[model samples]
Target: MPELPEVEVVRAGLAPAVTGATVISAEVRDPRALKRHLPLGADGLPGDDGLGGHGVRLPFEAGVARAADFERRVTGLVLDAPRRRGKFMWIPVERGAGDESQPGSVPIPLVERGARDESKPDQLALLAHLGMSGQMLLRAHDAPDDRHVRIRLWIEHPAHGELRLDFADQRLFGSLALDRLLPAPDGIDLIPGQALHIARDPLDPAFDDAGFLLALRRRGVGVKKLLLDQTLVSGVGNIYADEALWRARIHPETPGTAIGPRKARELLSALRDVFTQALAEGGTSFDAQYVNVNGQAGYFAHSLNAYGRQGAPCPRCGRPIVRESFMNRGSHFCPKCQQLR
Candidate 1:
């Protein structure tokens, strides 16, 4: 799966090209990619609260109908700057060309539900999650369809002319949806309904460092597992978790309660350093699927020290690195350098 840095790269690439662009048409070749499009309510907003629980559920009807509905609503909406949280990315949508009530009206910003007045209209955003093998590629206006392209958006930008954004997913696990915008739990800013549950990443300026350290000292779960928890801290996946632990010289299986405040802070700093380095290298790409919008591979795989170096010598100590089975995945570490203490 593409992690935080990979998603951030895509968001950055999309910001300039798609900002202020109007969607001329939306083609859904495979309706499966529209799985995340939630049904709307009588008030023209999402059927339920932004939380994942207790919402209007998707039905068992033919997916083509759902795809049609998605296209109908998404067409003619203007895109604002692309935003991201954890591995999720979305574009703030504005009513533009296709709206019948106010054709050619200037685009209005999406207001948070908490602050929105009754007289104002509801707002929506285009949410995207790159499950396993998904790719959002930017191709020419008339370029041939890429393999497994589930959805295509033919958009017109005021400065860039016609452009095509293709959502290609080989495994059919990723999705595109038009979700309502709601105020974040902390009242920080508005976010897509589907992404409301994700916690702030370490790179976020609003991330609470002291709160994280306090929480880390109280959790009874293994330190690595706690780090991977999206609610506890967003964006640190298996690869970065292992590398951060190795840098902090903490065993993956060590309980969070066993780590002191100094050690916990060290782990957090290590995570930030790892993510920064990965972003600079364009993210850790090991295959063709995980690439930037332009289809270029990342070089961070070469700088890894612990994650994929099983049986190789540890860069810190002379001991060999080992791999252990963990939650259906593998955990690699320098056994000699990282102790249970």
Candidate 2:
């Protein structure tokens, strides 16, 4: 699965290309997942250019020359830009990182209301969540369809003009949403600079030391399982959870509620370091699916401390990193380094 870092890369790559353009057309091979993403009644989409009408609006030569090519292509899924919520990628009304109200709290302007007129709307946010096996790629305007392309879009850009695109998902768990309503999860903040819901990034200044200790000490679940809870902290996926716990020198199964405040800081710091490093590597890829926007493997895999390095040597104590099952998922850690409390 593409994590926050990998998806951010894709979004960064796509932002300039998709923003300001109207959806020329959109085609969904998997309508079931598409419905989950962009519910019909919600209608958060841009002014529909009726997929067929776009062809006529194009230059005579451009339209006719591409008639055969555009025949079956879904008209327009104009991407006005996209946003992310923990793991859920969405399109909001404005462009840029958007106005940050406070940490984990950003106003998501959706739905045409008195607040935002439909005629002068800045852009309709194209929210997407690339689940475990999903990705969005920018291809040539007339690029041939690849084998994994489940969702396709023909976007008109400012500089590049018309560019055909694909949102490929092997697992079909990822989704797309044309939201008219920016539904926020209860209790989770969306401020751009402040903490995200599930993610208390190590880099943030508000990395609640006291709160961290309290959160962990309150939960009896294994540290690994507790890390996976988005409600507790946003964006700490399985890979990150495993890595952070390993770095903290605590077994993945050590109950979070049992860890002390001093150790809690270590755990939190390690989480920040792991995610910050992985984001720079463009996110990790142990499986065949997770490649960056440029289709390159991440650099973090070569330096993994314990997530997938099961039987491999622990980078720290030179002992073997052990792997086992916890919470129905694989748990890896350095046995010698992480003593049981």
Candidate 3:
């Protein structure tokens, strides 16, 4: 699965092309890919518009199979720049030009980047989750369809010509959905309703370090487990968790309550440093499954110290790194350096 850095890379690449662009139409090649969408009506047609009828439902092809609601709701809505929180990425609706219910109604304010007027009407966003082998590729409209492409959205940009955004998933674990955009608990940013429980990543400017440290010293769970907890601190996956723990000289299984404030702060700082470096390098890509919108692999995989370095000599200490089974995956660390305390 693509972590925070990987998702951020995709979000950044899609920002310029998708922002202020119009969604011409949507084609669902696979119904399983839209499992997260609203349930269809008994008549197998779109029911009431969940977005308060803010967007007009455009006519869709009746010949197509699968969910037509995804296609109808997505069409005709202008999109804002793609936004991300942790591994979750979404493109919010900038405006519904064809909406005649409220003529000349001001467009809803975008979350985070736009003004925060709680009184504004709710909006919708196209939410995406790249499971194991999902890729979002921006291709020329006439280009050959990517293998295993589950969904395609035809979009037209003001400056750029028509383009196709392909959502391809080899393992069929990823999904796309039309979800409501609601203000986060902090009220500082807007997040898709499905991702509301995810905590802010360490790189987020609003991330509370002091509060996190306080919580870290209270949990009895393993420190690594705590890091992986999306509600506690989102985006620190297995790969980066080991790396950050190595930098902090703490064992992966070290209980969070056993870690003092000084060590907790050090771990937090190490996480941010690792995330920053990974973002700079695009993101860690061990296989072709993970790539940016341009279908380019990240280079951060080459800079890894702990994860996937089993039996390799540690950079800090000369001891060979060991791999241990963890949560159905492998955890790599330097035993000599990161001793259980």
What is the C-alpha local distance difference test score of each model? 0.83, 0.62, 0.81
- Pairs that collide, model 1: none
Full ranking by lDDT: 1, 3, 2
> Per-residue error at 255 for model 3, in Å?
0.4
TM-score of each: 0.90, 0.74, 0.86
Say which candidate scores most in TM-score.
1
| Ten contiguous residues minimizing lDDT sum, candidate 2 | 65-74
Tens digits of lDDT, candidate 3, 1-341: 58888889989999989998898889988766764565344443323324222132322332132356677667778989898887888999855576434433333333322465656555788899887778889998899877889999999999888999999998767778877787799999778888999999999999988888888889998899999998889888888999899889899999999998889999999999999999999998998889999899999999999999999999998899999998898889999999986
Rank by TM-score, highest first: 1, 3, 2
Report the C-alpha lDDT of model 1 over 211-248, residue by residue, as the tens digit: 88999999898999999998889988889999999999
Of candidates 2 and 1, the better by lDDT: 1
